[model samples]
Target: MLVTLEGLDGSGKTTVWERLRSDDMVPDETVFTREPTDTWYGDAVQRSIDDDDADSLAELFLYTADHAAHLSNTVRPALEENRLVVSDRYSDSRYAYQGATLADSEMLDDPLSYVREVHAPWTRPPDRTVYLDLDPETAAKRSGATNKFETADYLATVRDNYERLIEADPERFVRVDATADPDTVYERVRDAIV
Candidate 1:
Protein backbone atom coordinates (compact mmCIF):
# COMPACT_ATOMS: atom_id res chain seq x y z
CA MET A 1 0.00 0.00 0.00
CA LEU A 2 1.21 3.48 -0.80
CA VAL A 3 -0.10 5.98 1.72
CA THR A 4 0.69 9.66 1.50
CA LEU A 5 -0.07 12.30 4.12
CA GLU A 6 -0.93 15.81 2.99
CA GLY A 7 -1.36 19.02 4.94
CA LEU A 8 0.11 22.45 5.55
CA ASP A 9 3.25 22.77 7.67
CA GLY A 10 2.77 22.20 11.42
CA SER A 11 -0.46 20.32 10.86
CA GLY A 12 1.02 17.53 13.00
CA LYS A 13 1.76 15.26 10.03
CA THR A 14 5.36 14.69 11.07
CA THR A 15 4.39 14.00 14.65
CA VAL A 16 1.69 11.54 13.60
CA TRP A 17 3.94 9.97 10.99
CA GLU A 18 6.62 9.46 13.61
CA ARG A 19 4.16 7.84 15.94
CA LEU A 20 2.97 5.46 13.23
CA ARG A 21 6.52 4.64 12.19
CA SER A 22 7.84 4.13 15.72
CA ASP A 23 4.88 2.00 16.66
CA ASP A 24 5.74 -0.39 13.80
CA MET A 25 2.13 -0.30 12.72
CA VAL A 26 2.81 -0.51 9.02
CA PRO A 27 5.51 -3.17 8.54
CA ASP A 28 9.18 -3.62 9.32
CA GLU A 29 10.15 -2.76 5.74
CA THR A 30 7.71 0.03 5.11
CA VAL A 31 9.59 2.76 3.32
CA PHE A 32 9.00 6.20 4.78
CA THR A 33 9.96 9.35 2.85
CA ARG A 34 9.26 13.05 2.47
CA GLU A 35 9.31 15.34 -0.53
CA PRO A 36 12.18 17.75 -0.90
CA THR A 37 13.80 14.38 -0.34
CA ASP A 38 17.51 14.20 0.41
CA THR A 39 18.76 14.63 -3.15
CA TRP A 40 20.33 17.31 -5.33
CA TYR A 41 16.99 18.30 -6.78
CA GLY A 42 15.60 18.23 -3.27
CA ASP A 43 18.42 20.55 -2.19
CA ALA A 44 17.44 22.99 -4.90
CA VAL A 45 13.85 22.77 -3.79
CA GLN A 46 14.86 23.44 -0.18
CA ARG A 47 16.97 26.42 -1.17
CA SER A 48 14.04 27.91 -3.06
CA ILE A 49 12.01 27.93 0.15
CA ASP A 50 13.69 31.09 1.49
CA ASP A 51 16.03 32.26 -1.26
CA ASP A 52 14.50 34.84 -3.57
CA ASP A 53 16.88 33.94 -6.39
CA ALA A 54 14.39 31.52 -7.91
CA ASP A 55 10.81 32.19 -8.85
CA SER A 56 7.83 29.94 -8.13
CA LEU A 57 8.09 28.22 -11.50
CA ALA A 58 11.69 27.34 -10.77
CA GLU A 59 10.67 26.04 -7.38
CA LEU A 60 7.98 23.93 -9.01
CA PHE A 61 10.42 22.39 -11.46
CA LEU A 62 12.90 21.70 -8.67
CA TYR A 63 10.24 19.90 -6.68
CA THR A 64 9.17 17.97 -9.77
CA ALA A 65 12.76 16.89 -10.34
CA ASP A 66 12.98 15.80 -6.73
CA HIS A 67 9.79 13.78 -7.13
CA ALA A 68 11.18 12.14 -10.24
CA ALA A 69 14.33 11.14 -8.41
CA HIS A 70 12.37 10.00 -5.39
CA LEU A 71 10.06 7.85 -7.51
CA SER A 72 12.88 6.25 -9.48
CA ASN A 73 15.13 5.70 -6.47
CA THR A 74 12.88 5.02 -3.49
CA VAL A 75 9.12 4.66 -4.00
CA ARG A 76 9.12 2.50 -7.09
CA PRO A 77 11.71 0.05 -5.82
CA ALA A 78 10.00 -0.39 -2.47
CA LEU A 79 6.61 -0.95 -4.06
CA GLU A 80 8.06 -3.43 -6.54
CA GLU A 81 9.28 -5.49 -3.62
CA ASN A 82 5.81 -5.35 -2.05
CA ARG A 83 6.79 -3.11 0.85
CA LEU A 84 4.32 -0.57 2.14
CA VAL A 85 5.44 3.01 1.51
CA VAL A 86 4.37 6.04 3.52
CA SER A 87 5.23 9.58 2.58
CA ASP A 88 4.91 12.81 4.54
CA ARG A 89 3.93 14.72 1.42
CA TYR A 90 3.58 14.21 -2.31
CA SER A 91 2.59 15.72 -5.66
CA ASP A 92 -0.59 17.20 -4.23
CA SER A 93 1.53 19.83 -2.52
CA ARG A 94 3.10 20.89 -5.78
CA TYR A 95 -0.32 21.33 -7.30
CA ALA A 96 -1.55 23.33 -4.31
CA TYR A 97 1.48 25.60 -3.94
CA GLN A 98 2.36 25.90 -7.57
CA GLY A 99 -1.24 26.23 -8.62
CA ALA A 100 -1.60 29.04 -6.13
CA THR A 101 1.60 30.62 -7.42
CA LEU A 102 0.42 30.28 -10.97
CA ALA A 103 -2.97 31.67 -10.08
CA ASP A 104 -1.98 35.02 -11.53
CA SER A 105 -0.41 33.39 -14.58
CA GLU A 106 -1.90 31.62 -17.57
CA MET A 107 -1.13 28.24 -16.03
CA LEU A 108 -3.92 28.69 -13.49
CA ASP A 109 -6.50 27.40 -15.93
CA ASP A 110 -5.17 23.84 -15.61
CA PRO A 111 -2.22 23.49 -13.29
CA LEU A 112 -2.78 19.79 -12.86
CA SER A 113 -2.88 19.31 -16.58
CA TYR A 114 0.41 21.16 -16.91
CA VAL A 115 2.02 19.09 -14.18
CA ARG A 116 0.65 15.92 -15.71
CA GLU A 117 2.02 16.75 -19.12
CA VAL A 118 5.40 17.64 -17.65
CA HIS A 119 5.89 15.20 -14.74
CA ALA A 120 3.24 12.52 -14.76
CA PRO A 121 5.22 10.11 -16.93
CA TRP A 122 7.68 9.52 -14.08
CA THR A 123 5.38 9.96 -11.11
CA ARG A 124 2.98 7.50 -9.52
CA PRO A 125 -0.13 8.56 -7.66
CA PRO A 126 -0.60 7.48 -4.08
CA ASP A 127 -3.14 4.74 -3.42
CA ARG A 128 -4.49 6.63 -0.46
CA THR A 129 -3.99 10.20 0.73
CA VAL A 130 -4.67 11.35 4.28
CA TYR A 131 -4.98 15.08 4.69
CA LEU A 132 -4.56 16.28 8.25
CA ASP A 133 -6.93 19.19 8.42
CA LEU A 134 -6.22 22.08 10.76
CA ASP A 135 -6.86 25.79 11.07
CA PRO A 136 -3.99 27.94 9.86
CA GLU A 137 -3.77 29.81 13.16
CA THR A 138 -3.33 26.59 15.14
CA ALA A 139 -0.93 25.18 12.57
CA ALA A 140 1.25 28.31 12.75
CA LYS A 141 1.38 28.08 16.50
CA ARG A 142 2.74 24.56 16.17
CA SER A 143 5.25 25.37 13.47
CA GLY A 144 7.24 28.55 13.85
CA ALA A 145 7.73 31.12 11.12
CA THR A 146 10.80 29.61 9.52
CA ASN A 147 9.89 29.79 5.86
CA LYS A 148 8.07 32.32 3.73
CA PHE A 149 5.72 29.55 2.62
CA GLU A 150 4.51 28.75 6.13
CA THR A 151 2.42 31.85 6.67
CA ALA A 152 -1.11 31.46 8.03
CA ASP A 153 -2.66 33.01 4.97
CA TYR A 154 -0.82 30.75 2.58
CA LEU A 155 -1.65 27.79 4.77
CA ALA A 156 -5.30 28.69 4.70
CA THR A 157 -5.20 28.81 0.95
CA VAL A 158 -3.34 25.54 0.90
CA ARG A 159 -6.00 24.04 3.14
CA ASP A 160 -8.71 25.21 0.80
CA ASN A 161 -6.91 23.81 -2.19
CA TYR A 162 -6.38 20.52 -0.38
CA GLU A 163 -10.07 20.25 0.34
CA ARG A 164 -10.88 20.98 -3.27
CA LEU A 165 -8.44 18.34 -4.36
CA ILE A 166 -10.00 15.88 -1.96
CA GLU A 167 -13.43 16.71 -3.24
CA ALA A 168 -12.29 16.32 -6.78
CA ASP A 169 -11.05 12.81 -6.02
CA PRO A 170 -12.98 11.52 -3.09
CA GLU A 171 -11.87 7.91 -3.32
CA ARG A 172 -8.20 8.64 -2.77
CA PHE A 173 -8.35 11.22 -0.01
CA VAL A 174 -9.30 10.82 3.65
CA ARG A 175 -9.56 14.08 5.54
CA VAL A 176 -8.93 13.89 9.26
CA ASP A 177 -9.30 16.57 11.87
CA ALA A 178 -5.77 17.26 13.04
CA THR A 179 -6.69 19.31 16.08
CA ALA A 180 -7.17 16.13 18.07
CA ASP A 181 -4.36 14.60 20.11
CA PRO A 182 -1.66 12.59 18.40
CA ASP A 183 -2.96 9.31 19.78
CA THR A 184 -6.39 9.99 18.44
CA VAL A 185 -5.00 10.95 15.07
CA TYR A 186 -2.87 7.81 14.95
CA GLU A 187 -5.81 5.64 15.81
CA ARG A 188 -7.90 7.19 13.08
CA VAL A 189 -5.12 6.78 10.56
CA ARG A 190 -4.56 3.20 11.62
CA ASP A 191 -8.22 2.40 11.25
CA ALA A 192 -8.25 4.00 7.85
CA ILE A 193 -5.28 1.91 6.81
CA VAL A 194 -6.77 -1.31 8.13
Candidate 2:
Protein backbone atom coordinates (compact mmCIF):
# COMPACT_ATOMS: atom_id res chain seq x y z
CA MET A 1 0.00 0.00 0.00
CA LEU A 2 1.42 3.36 -1.06
CA VAL A 3 -0.36 5.72 1.35
CA THR A 4 0.49 9.38 0.87
CA LEU A 5 -0.51 12.11 3.31
CA GLU A 6 -1.42 15.46 1.77
CA GLY A 7 -2.40 18.88 3.15
CA LEU A 8 -1.23 22.45 3.77
CA ASP A 9 1.74 23.04 6.05
CA GLY A 10 0.88 22.82 9.78
CA SER A 11 -2.21 20.84 8.89
CA GLY A 12 -1.11 18.13 11.38
CA LYS A 13 0.32 15.85 8.68
CA THR A 14 3.53 15.40 10.67
CA THR A 15 1.75 14.85 13.96
CA VAL A 16 -0.65 12.32 12.47
CA TRP A 17 2.11 10.69 10.45
CA GLU A 18 4.14 10.21 13.63
CA ARG A 19 1.23 8.53 15.32
CA LEU A 20 0.69 6.30 12.33
CA ARG A 21 4.37 5.41 12.55
CA SER A 22 5.02 4.78 16.30
CA ASP A 23 1.64 3.15 16.85
CA ASP A 24 2.39 0.31 14.41
CA MET A 25 -0.98 1.07 12.84
CA VAL A 26 -0.16 -0.20 9.42
CA PRO A 27 0.93 -3.69 8.40
CA ASP A 28 4.19 -5.09 9.77
CA GLU A 29 5.81 -4.58 6.38
CA THR A 30 5.28 -0.81 6.44
CA VAL A 31 8.11 1.58 5.52
CA PHE A 32 7.85 5.31 6.17
CA THR A 33 9.45 8.01 3.94
CA ARG A 34 8.86 11.45 2.45
CA GLU A 35 9.51 13.56 -0.65
CA PRO A 36 12.16 16.24 -1.14
CA THR A 37 14.31 13.34 -0.02
CA ASP A 38 17.62 13.68 1.78
CA THR A 39 19.46 13.54 -1.55
CA TRP A 40 20.88 16.50 -3.49
CA TYR A 41 17.53 16.67 -5.25
CA GLY A 42 16.05 17.34 -1.82
CA ASP A 43 18.74 19.91 -1.07
CA ALA A 44 18.03 21.71 -4.34
CA VAL A 45 14.30 22.03 -3.54
CA GLN A 46 15.10 23.29 -0.04
CA ARG A 47 17.55 25.82 -1.42
CA SER A 48 15.03 26.92 -4.04
CA ILE A 49 12.44 27.60 -1.35
CA ASP A 50 14.85 29.89 0.49
CA ASP A 51 15.93 31.57 -2.73
CA ASP A 52 14.13 34.92 -3.05
CA ASP A 53 14.15 34.86 -6.84
CA ALA A 54 13.12 31.25 -7.40
CA ASP A 55 10.97 30.90 -10.48
CA SER A 56 7.67 29.06 -10.09
CA LEU A 57 8.40 26.78 -13.03
CA ALA A 58 11.94 26.15 -11.81
CA GLU A 59 10.70 25.26 -8.35
CA LEU A 60 8.19 22.88 -9.89
CA PHE A 61 10.95 21.20 -11.90
CA LEU A 62 13.08 20.86 -8.77
CA TYR A 63 10.25 19.04 -7.04
CA THR A 64 9.77 16.78 -10.05
CA ALA A 65 13.45 15.83 -9.98
CA ASP A 66 13.20 15.08 -6.27
CA HIS A 67 10.22 12.84 -6.92
CA ALA A 68 12.09 10.95 -9.61
CA ALA A 69 15.02 10.26 -7.29
CA HIS A 70 12.71 9.44 -4.40
CA LEU A 71 10.88 6.82 -6.44
CA SER A 72 13.93 5.25 -8.05
CA ASN A 73 16.14 5.34 -4.95
CA THR A 74 13.67 4.88 -2.10
CA VAL A 75 9.97 4.08 -2.73
CA ARG A 76 10.13 1.47 -5.50
CA PRO A 77 12.77 -0.64 -3.79
CA ALA A 78 10.71 -0.84 -0.59
CA LEU A 79 7.55 -1.69 -2.50
CA GLU A 80 9.36 -4.26 -4.60
CA GLU A 81 10.18 -6.07 -1.39
CA ASN A 82 6.44 -6.06 -0.49
CA ARG A 83 6.71 -3.33 2.11
CA LEU A 84 3.77 -0.96 2.50
CA VAL A 85 5.13 2.52 1.78
CA VAL A 86 3.65 5.42 3.74
CA SER A 87 4.85 8.79 2.52
CA ASP A 88 4.60 12.12 4.30
CA ARG A 89 3.81 13.91 1.03
CA TYR A 90 3.71 12.98 -2.62
CA SER A 91 2.93 14.26 -6.13
CA ASP A 92 -0.37 15.73 -4.91
CA SER A 93 1.60 18.38 -3.03
CA ARG A 94 3.14 19.50 -6.32
CA TYR A 95 -0.22 19.62 -8.09
CA ALA A 96 -1.75 21.54 -5.20
CA TYR A 97 1.09 23.95 -4.37
CA GLN A 98 3.04 24.42 -7.60
CA GLY A 99 0.01 24.09 -9.83
CA ALA A 100 -1.65 26.89 -7.82
CA THR A 101 1.55 28.95 -7.96
CA LEU A 102 1.73 28.65 -11.73
CA ALA A 103 -1.98 29.06 -12.42
CA ASP A 104 -1.61 32.74 -13.29
CA SER A 105 1.69 32.42 -15.10
CA GLU A 106 1.68 33.35 -18.81
CA MET A 107 4.74 31.10 -19.18
CA LEU A 108 2.66 27.94 -19.41
CA ASP A 109 -0.51 27.49 -21.44
CA ASP A 110 -1.78 25.22 -18.60
CA PRO A 111 0.24 24.75 -15.46
CA LEU A 112 -1.64 21.76 -14.15
CA SER A 113 -1.46 20.03 -17.53
CA TYR A 114 2.25 20.81 -17.73
CA VAL A 115 2.85 19.58 -14.18
CA ARG A 116 0.91 16.39 -14.90
CA GLU A 117 2.95 15.94 -18.07
CA VAL A 118 6.27 16.51 -16.28
CA HIS A 119 5.39 13.99 -13.62
CA ALA A 120 3.59 11.51 -15.91
CA PRO A 121 6.32 8.90 -16.04
CA TRP A 122 7.18 8.95 -12.32
CA THR A 123 3.66 9.48 -10.94
CA ARG A 124 2.57 6.59 -8.79
CA PRO A 125 -1.11 6.37 -7.93
CA PRO A 126 -1.53 6.20 -4.19
CA ASP A 127 -3.43 3.24 -2.90
CA ARG A 128 -5.05 5.76 -0.59
CA THR A 129 -4.43 9.45 0.18
CA VAL A 130 -5.24 11.03 3.53
CA TYR A 131 -5.75 14.77 3.26
CA LEU A 132 -5.69 16.56 6.59
CA ASP A 133 -8.02 19.42 5.73
CA LEU A 134 -7.41 22.65 7.65
CA ASP A 135 -8.27 26.17 6.62
CA PRO A 136 -5.41 28.54 5.75
CA GLU A 137 -6.07 30.85 8.70
CA THR A 138 -5.70 28.10 11.27
CA ALA A 139 -2.75 26.58 9.49
CA ALA A 140 -0.99 29.93 9.34
CA LYS A 141 -1.50 30.40 13.06
CA ARG A 142 0.14 27.05 13.72
CA SER A 143 3.08 27.65 11.40
CA GLY A 144 3.81 31.31 10.83
CA ALA A 145 5.67 32.52 7.75
CA THR A 146 7.54 29.36 6.91
CA ASN A 147 8.09 30.07 3.24
CA LYS A 148 6.97 32.07 0.18
CA PHE A 149 3.76 30.07 -0.17
CA GLU A 150 2.71 30.30 3.50
CA THR A 151 0.35 33.21 3.03
CA ALA A 152 -3.37 32.78 3.74
CA ASP A 153 -4.35 33.68 0.18
CA TYR A 154 -1.84 31.31 -1.38
CA LEU A 155 -2.69 28.46 0.97
CA ALA A 156 -6.36 29.00 0.29
CA THR A 157 -5.65 28.60 -3.41
CA VAL A 158 -3.60 25.47 -2.69
CA ARG A 159 -6.45 24.10 -0.59
CA ASP A 160 -8.82 24.66 -3.47
CA ASN A 161 -6.46 22.80 -5.78
CA TYR A 162 -6.39 19.86 -3.36
CA GLU A 163 -10.19 19.85 -3.22
CA ARG A 164 -10.33 19.75 -6.99
CA LEU A 165 -7.90 16.84 -7.05
CA ILE A 166 -9.99 14.95 -4.54
CA GLU A 167 -13.18 15.76 -6.43
CA ALA A 168 -11.66 14.50 -9.65
CA ASP A 169 -10.98 11.14 -8.00
CA PRO A 170 -12.94 10.83 -4.78
CA GLU A 171 -11.82 7.28 -4.12
CA ARG A 172 -8.17 8.33 -4.11
CA PHE A 173 -8.57 10.80 -1.23
CA VAL A 174 -9.89 10.65 2.34
CA ARG A 175 -10.54 14.02 3.97
CA VAL A 176 -9.79 14.45 7.68
CA ASP A 177 -10.77 17.49 9.72
CA ALA A 178 -7.38 18.58 11.05
CA THR A 179 -8.85 21.10 13.47
CA ALA A 180 -9.59 18.24 15.83
CA ASP A 181 -7.12 17.18 18.54
CA PRO A 182 -4.19 15.03 17.48
CA ASP A 183 -5.52 11.83 19.05
CA THR A 184 -8.91 12.37 17.50
CA VAL A 185 -7.33 13.13 14.15
CA TYR A 186 -5.16 10.03 14.40
CA GLU A 187 -8.25 7.92 14.96
CA ARG A 188 -9.85 9.32 11.84
CA VAL A 189 -6.61 8.77 9.91
CA ARG A 190 -6.43 5.12 10.95
CA ASP A 191 -10.05 4.65 10.02
CA ALA A 192 -9.44 6.26 6.66
CA ILE A 193 -6.57 3.92 5.82
CA VAL A 194 -7.41 1.01 3.53
Scored by lDDT, the top model is 2
Residue 92 lDDT in candidate 1: 91
Worst 10 residues of 1 by lDDT: 107-116
The model with the greatest TM-score is: 2
lDDT per model, in order? 0.81, 0.87
Q: TM-scores of the models, in the given order?
A: 0.92, 0.95
**Candidate 1: where is the Cα deviation over 4 Å?**
none
Off by over 4 Å in 2: none
Task: Give the clash count for each candidate.
Answer: 0, 0
Q: What count of clashes does model 2 give? A: 0
